[model samples]
Target: MLDLLNDLLWGKVLIGLLIAVGIGFTLGSRFVQFRYFGRMFRILGASQAFKRDKHGHLSSFQALLLSVAGRVGGGNIAGVAVAITLGGPGAIFWMWLVGLMGMATSYLECTLAQAYKTAQPDGTYRGGPAYYIARGLGQRWKWLAALYSVLLLVTFGFGFTALQSYAVATSFDDAFGIPVVFTGLGMAVIVGLIIFGGIKRIARVAEVLVPVMAVGYLLIAVVVLGMNLPRIPEVFLLIVNSAFGLEPAIGGSIGAAIMMGVKRGLFSNEAGLGSAPNVAAVAYVPHPANQGIVQAFSVFLDTLVICSATAFIILLSGAYDPASGADIGGVALTQVSLADHVGEWGRSFVSVALLLFGFSTILYNYYLGENSLNFFSESNVTLFNLFRIAVVVLCAWGAMTDLGTVFAFADVTMGFLALANLIALLMLFKPGLRIMRDFDEQIRAGIRHPVFDAKKFADLDIDPAAWEIEPEDIERLKRYGAPPPSASQPVK
Candidate 1:
């Protein structure tokens, strides 16, 4: 039944929808992802990106790191191997395509998330597909919002985190002979410590650890690729040939390549899957598009940079042969390939890297669940604590269980989650376009940094408290004296 559902959802429906939506967003926004590609790095270096305040809200950079934590996980390593095993080396090319197109899709969804975000009592923010679907699309469509929240809770909160736990436990068991049960229990305990401290704690941890683990893993890939520099051109040619069926290899058909690449690509970067926007909404940015652009870069980092690293390591080591019939795959395939290059130490490094990746992802996934749960009830402390306990138990259970069923379940839920978000995005398309236009107009008008004016969007359902202009912003507007209807005054 699970296999049949996956076949129906992924094989037929989502592959086309994912590509079409990505292209639509890219064209509709005039390729905002690329237009502001260089600007993204500039925004990251801005002082606002790291600023914290009396309110415990996340800075723009912290939000980016948190979302990156969610994107770079077991999928970058183990999931890439699975794509190669089932879809051949050509799958890497399709993954690259998805990552590129996904940049636009991520930008649109996350920008909408920021536009519709609400201020919470604890001085934090809350928004995502759930908030936007209900508020942006009107109250009559709140059922759709509830549905999105439920799917997010299931997909990220339980299913994906459980899978992360399973990956880490299995890696330790393979590398150090550690029992899966012991690894599972230890991970669950650590998770409990951070989650109980709340979103602030999660943000702090992700900001510190995400960059370290991602850089460390990429450095290892660099060394391995450098050692085999002569084969770099050959590997690139093989990927392109296999992608177009110019080369004969296992699972080398164009259809299989497109399907597996897209599936695993979405799993890795989560561009249109609606997960990243949950954290994206938490950021404090002058313009909603600022955070959106930051998130689009994250998809690039996850699939293009990190996932490609894993692909090169596996393909270059010759541990994964399309011509040969061998059963090696997943994290083990990656471990074997690395070990081939650097001996047994490489295997242990992968085990440790996966532990950090999976651990950070668990932190990210748990926050998504908590945010979704808040949609139904904000003050239900009892229910919140119980949900946390349930997640901890699921983490431990997933580590010890066979993952066939769990993985299937996660794929199905993820498909539905993306389906819901894409529909909401399409419905709210014009408003999203207007938001982007607002930012563009500001930049074109000689404002070096765009600041959102809620009065300009009075027709929308945005919370004024979330976009209240700061006194510093008022001063900055005074300095720019070029436009009528100053930012401080209401637009007539």
Candidate 2:
């Protein structure tokens, strides 16, 4: 029943909707993701992108890091291996194409998120598909918002936390012989500390650790790939040929390759699934599209950079077997491939990497669920707090319990969440494009620091507080060329 539902939701329904919406956004925005690609690096390089610009909150770049933290987890390693293993090397091409198209989907969803975000009591922000569906669509459509929130709560808050903790526990147990129970408790403690500190701490930690871990992992992949430089062409041919059914050894047909590629790629980067926008909306940027551009770059980093690293490491090492690919998945394939290429130490590295990757992802997932709960009732501390406690408990349980059921539950819920989110994205696409155009016109006029004026968008049913500039912060930004003190946190 679970498998049937998943096939129906993801394979039969979402594949077309996902790609269509992505292509639509890409065209609607006139390929803003590409035209603004270089500006992504410029914004990232300047502190304006990372420092607060709106009410004191996470910066645009920090929000990107937060979203990337969610995107970069163990899936980059194990998931890529599974895609190539089952889908054939051809699946890599599909993943790349989805990553490209999904960039626009991510942009449109996040732009709406930023435009509709609510100012939280603690000077932080919270929003996502739910917030946008309500504010962007209308008050009457709030039920759809509530529906998306519920699905997000179930999938990320409960289901994914367990899955992540399970990965961490199993990896640590395999690597250091730490008992799953012990690892679970320790993991829970670390998570409790950070989440208790709220979004500020989560963003701080992501800014520091995410970049370090991602760069280190990629450096290692580069070295391994460098060693196999001669076979690079062969592996490339396999991935490309296998995708189109030109290579019979990799799979049975082109459809299988496309399905596996799109499925895993969509799942891995979460381009249009509505998850990243939860973090995206928290960023303090001059224009809503600023964060959208940053989030689109994140898709590139996740699928193109991190996921591709895993694929190359596996294929380049000659460790992946298409004949037995069905059995190759998750941590096992990653561990085996790295161990074969770089010595047994590579296996231990992967284990440690998975532990960090899964744990960071769990942190981000907690925030997503917490944000969902906030949408229901910001005044109800008891409920969202209770959900957080539940998340911590489930994280530990996921580490020790049989996860077959949990994984299945996660899949079904995620499929539904994507369905809800994609619908909202399509409906809200035009307004989102307008916001993007506003930002683009500013850039075209050579405005280095393009500030958004909410008055212009008064026609939209938006929370004015989101775009209102605090009076004191204006002079401070003019004087120092950075945002006010509230925007800067104590660096981790």
Candidate 3:
């Protein structure tokens, strides 16, 4: 049943849905991805919303790390390899194309998450398709929200996390002859330590680790590209040529290339999958669109940066035989490719990379699972605790299993999750657009630093605390020598 459903959803329906939405959103949002691409960096470097408050919730930068932790993971490596193997090297062109348009889709979904967010008594926030569907669309849509939560729980919470662990285990297995079960147990312990510390720990770890791994991986890719300097132009040509069936070396149909690329790109960057917005909503940004732009940049980082690095590494090493690689897609292929180019040490380097990438992704998945259960009731402590255990157990179990089956199951559930989110996004898009307009108008008015006013949106379901700024809190922060209000986190 799952295979059949996955075949239909991934091969046919979701492809068009994803593409159409990406294009529509790209145009509708006035090229938000490109227009504000530079601003993403400005926010990253200058934004002071990264301070740790008394609560466990993360700041904007930490939230970006959390989201990136999920976005730039095993999928960026193994998943891209799978796409290239099945779809041909031309597949990367299609991935780039999807990524180009996905920025707008990411902005829309994330902005909606911020606008419709609800604050909990614990001074934390929770929002996503579930929250927005219920609050923005009305209580009549509560069932749809719950359905989304269930799908997300299955998709990110369990299935996808398992795949990350599986990739880690396989990489280690290929590298050191480490047994899968042992790797699984080790992974479970590491995951339990961080996840038990909750979102704060995850964010803290991500803020530090994500940048290091991403930059290190890119640096290695640049080094690899230098080693194959003459092949650089040829690599670009092959990608474009294969995408359009102009390259006969691929020996595959253009349709296969398009489908595989879109699938892997969607899974890797998670632009419209409705997963990132759950974390995006948790961020304490001055404007909802601020987080939207940050996450839009994240899509670029995931597909254009990390995944591209993996593709280049594999292609440059000349390790991927289209015919043979199709049967052996995933981290092992990457490990071999790096080894072929760099040396015997390449295998060990990739294993360590996989461990960090996959472990961070597991943290992302666990966070999403807790939010999913909380969607039903934040006070459901039993469900939350049990789900945490399930995540740890499944993370271990997944490492011991074949990942081909794991990826397929995740695709099916994610298909449904995206469908729910896309529908809600279209229906509730105006509020997000309104928020974007507010952001744009502020920029135009020379506000240099935009501060959101919750009272201006009294009609929406936004939690007032999210926009509220207490004088004493300001004094406390100032006394600690906290920086000025960032354009991301403005003072009231």
Candidate 4:
């Protein structure tokens, strides 16, 4: 069953759909991501409404941190190595291309998440692909919502939960001579403590750890790239030629390049996967667009900055070769590449990095599963907790299984969920555009602010308007902030 699933999903059908959705979003949104690039960075770096919230759950930076925690995980290390192994160096180029367009898709989906966000009874916010599917497309298609919930629970909770643990276990075994099973047990206990405390604790951990780790890894990559600076031009040519199957740097063929690039690129950045939006909706800020832009910038950070860093390090280290055995994938592959540059200690460092990256992703994925459960009932906390514990057990179990099968299951399930999410994005494009226009109008007018405030959404009927954003109040998000809802189209 798993093999069949891999055959069906890892082929052209899934790749085409993923690429098509990215293109559709880019075209549909009038390339808002590119047009507003400077504005997005300005909003992320500013500091003002750090504490304000109408019915707040997390600060803008906290939200960014949570989303980054998920994106910059095991995938960056293991996934990229795996991508290059199968897809060749050219795959790097394809990954970059998808990320470029994927920013728009992420913006649209996350904006819709904010647009239809539901206010929690505990004065918090909850929204994701499921919420948008139900509300944006109307409540009649409850099955769509239900299906999304189920897929998320399985893909994230069961499939990905275990995948993360397995990465941690493998890394520990390789670096410290520790048993994989005990490592899994340790991981479960840590996860249990943090998750039991809920999103706030998770957000706190992510906020502190994510930035430090991301910069640390990037610095390492810089060192590797600097060492091999002279060969940079040749590497660039190889990447381009391989992407087109002309250079054959890694057995140049269009099929190999496209497949490897698309697969790894999608896995690394997850631009169309619909996971980041879950975190994006919880930000305490003004306008769905505010969070949407933040989410898009994340894709840039993930693929353009972070993933690019990984590719440069691996390629420049001279450790990966298509004709040789050095083309290792995933965590092990990255360890090999890093070790080549930094020596034996580099393997230990890579292992530690993988542990942090994979653990943070598991934290975020669990939070997403928690939100999906909310669609059923707001107070099913105990059942969700149990489910998460079970996930921990499976994570341990996954450590002893075949990695190829483990990844295959995760890949197929994740692809299916992304398909559903992209469909939702396609259907909600019109409404998302209207919200963007509405937000821009409000920002241009002096009446609106940029932080979370229900007043900004009072005259608006969009479900996400359930809470309003105040422009003057949001920290790290002031430049593009808007004030109260404008009079242009007051809710009837």
Best by TM-score: 1
- Model 1 segments more than 4 A misplaced: 47-50, 472-492
lDDT tens digits by residue: candidate 4, 245-330:
78745744677777777777777777777888888878755567878888888888988888888777788775777687543577
| Model 1 per-residue lDDT tens digits across residues 1-492 | 888988898788877787898999899889888999898877776635336665565788889999999899988988999999888889999999999999999999999999999987776788899999989999889999999999999988988888888889988998999999999999889898888888888888887899899999999999998999999999999888888989875555777887789889977888878999999999877779999999999999999999999999999996877567777888889999999898989999999999999999999999999989999998578888998898889779889988888789988888899889888988998999999999999889887678787777878888878876445544544454323335553321
Candidate 4 error regions (>4 Å)? 46-48, 51-56, 325-327, 400-406, 442-461, 469-492
Candidate 2: tens digits of C-alpha lDDT, residues 1-492: 999998898888999999999999889889988999988876666545337544456677788889999999978888887777677788889999999999999989888999888877666787899988988888889899999999998899988999899888988888889999999988888888788777888998998889888998999899988889999999888888888778876743688789889988999999889999999998876668778889999999999989999888888775677675456566788888888899989988998888778888999999998988888888477886687688779877888987998898799999989999999888887898889888877777766555666667878777767765656545544453433323322111
How far out, in Å, is residue 404 in model 1? Answer: 2.9
Off by more than 4 A, model 2? 48-55, 323-327, 470-492
Error of 4 at 156 (Å): 0.2
Clashes of each: 0, 2, 0, 25
Shift in Å, residue 174, candidate 1: 1.2
Q: Give the Cα-based TM-score of candidate 1 against the true structure.
A: 0.95
Local accuracy of candidate 3 as per-residue lDDT tens digits, 199-261: 767778888889888888889889999999999898889889999999785735798888888
TM-score of each: 0.95, 0.93, 0.92, 0.90
Q: Which stretches of candidate 3 lie over 4 Å from their true place?
A: 54-57, 321-328, 402-407, 470-492
Q: Comparing 1 and 2 by TM-score, which wins?
A: 1
On TM-score, the stronger of 1 and 3 is 1
TM-score of 4: 0.90
